[model samples]
Target: MNPTIQLEQQYLVHAYNRAPFVFTDGEGVWLQDDAGNRYLDLVAGIAVNALGYGDAELVQVMQAAASKPLHYSNLYHSQPMAQLAARLVQVTPFAERIHFQNSGTECNEAAIKFARKWARSHFGEGKTDIIAFSGAFHGRTMGALAATPRPKYQDPFRPLMPGVRLAEFNDPDSLAATIDDHVCAVIVEPVQGEGGIHPATPAFMSALRELCHRHNALLILDEVQCGVGRTGTFWAHETYGIMPDILCAAKPLAAGLPIGAVLTSGRVAEAIHPGDHGTTFAGGPFVTAVANVVVERVSQPAFLRHVSETGAYFQEKLQEINSPHIIEVRGKGLMLGVQLDMPTAPIIQAGYQHGLLLLNAGADVLRLIPPLIISRDEVDIAVERLTAILTKSA
Candidate 1:
């Protein structure tokens, strides 16, 4: 066995099924592995690398911040932290105040806690039920895992946080059936990523909004994967013409740095006390500084418009692949999936062999969350290679 692989196998917990190859470096849409093979990174570190790898601007930002304080506890205020909060509030319609965290799970956790607090404050403890949806992938922490409701993810951690009910995604009738006055919040993904890249219907988002409002419940949009220009808009809920009361986003916010945030309205924001929730490492100088640049760049009108145009073009080309195995192609902007009748594991394996990195959203859906900065030519290259690979598989 290779010494490095052997050492990793011996030491690390067998949790993730990682690929054998080790990538040495990356630039733009491509990564160079240990053996000098170049692969196009369609996954973008599972949609965390919105600006792509080795970006000059990001590198400059990092270099500039390297001279300053790298990190400080959440006790003291920092320039980047305040600036990033201001930027988040300006860009996100839902954010009256932003609470920073270290990952998507943490952000979702904050949202969950805030919802419960808000519910308890507004209508008493009875209104503490949190309504999540089937096929929703919130995060992996206890609170997030409970809301996720996937048996595979929840069964082991039995007796998770109570008061979590599962409704159906993209089905207003199902949401109506599950949610009521007892529910404090209904959390959903504007575009379901891990549950096979399912985009919620406009009717469903609108109805969810109305249902939450009618019951005086908070609406939480877990945009961890679908936000930050991945869905052709700053926030996926924007496309539906409805706003969430609490919006959680993390992946790609800092262009691959670990950062998550809970953006909330004034009602949800003010319900909490001074020490109700906090984080030790969130909104530090380094991460927030990088995030400020990332948010500033991604939230630009021209940049978002480009993403919309490129995403439409990419989807059109995907449909034009003219392959029999492709059952359907769905999702918005750059966050897309190609569903096949067959299991996608082999296809994903073949992608690595063919120098195209791919990710699986489910058993049958091949997820493509390439960088936001990927141009049409890069998209064409990816599409052409994917077509050839699919042809060979067929």
Candidate 2:
């Protein structure tokens, strides 16, 4: 066995099935393992590294912040947190207030609490249930895990939270039927990331918004993996033209820094009192400062337009490969997936051997969430490598 792998197995908890190779460093679109082998990084730390690895600006900011104050309690106001909140509100359509968390799961927890609080305050204790989509993945915490509808993830931890119902995504009738007066919120992903790169239909999103309004339920969009310019927009819901009442953002928000947030409308913000919810590491200065820089860079109109053009070009190139194993290509902007007729494990392994890194969503969907700053040349390289692997695997 490899020395590093041996050491890791001895010390680390066996929670994740990590790849064999241990990456030593990364720069731009390239990553180098310990043996000096280079691979094109299409996964981008599972869609967290927005500006790619070794971003000088982010490095400088993080280093400077580290030297000063690493972390402080949320009781005291921090400039970075205040600045990031302001920046998020200024860039996004519905960002009345921001509640920070350490990870996407924690952010979802905060959203769930806020939604329930809003419901209880407006419609009494009866309105406490939350409707989540069938293929949605909020997070792994208890509350967020309950919102996640996958049996594989929830079976062991059965009897999660009560009043949580699952509705088929992109199906307006299913969602409408599940939501009622008791449904405090309907949490969904604009583009379902882990449940396969499934983009929500515009009609469905519009209808969901209307339905939420009718039943006085809040609409929460979890953009943990697809937000922050990954889908060529500041917010994935922007493409659907329907604003959510509460939006959860994380992943690339801070360009690989640990940060998560819940952006809510003024109404939802006002509903939650100070004592209702809180986090110690929430809205730390260092992470928020880094996030402020990332937000400003990603929210540029011209940059977003470029992302759209690049995504179209990338998809066109992918289609040109014409691999028989590929069943369909779906998704928007940089967040795409190739649905394979066969299992994706062999193909992903083959891609790894051919100096490419990829991720899988479900059994057959090959997720492609590269850095938003990836260029056409890098896209071409990734496509070539992936096509070769797909051809061989097929």
Clashing pairs in 1: none
Tens digit of per-residue lDDT, candidate 2, span 118-142: 8888888799888988889998878
Return the lDDT, model 2, position 51: 89
Report the lDDT tens digits of candidate 1 across residue range 1-394: 6677888899999998988788889999899987899998899999999998898988999999999989888888899989999999999776799999999999999998999899888788688889998899998889999988788998988889998988888889999898889999989999999999999999999999999999988999999999999999898889798988999999999888899989999989889888999988998899999999999999999999989999999999999997789999988999999999899988899998889999999899999999998899999988998998887886
Provide backbone clash counts, one per model: 0, 0
The RMSD (Cα, Å) of candidate 2 is 1.0
lDDT of 2 at 308: 83
Clashing residue pairs in candidate 2, if any? none
- TM-score of model 1 relative to the true fold? 0.98
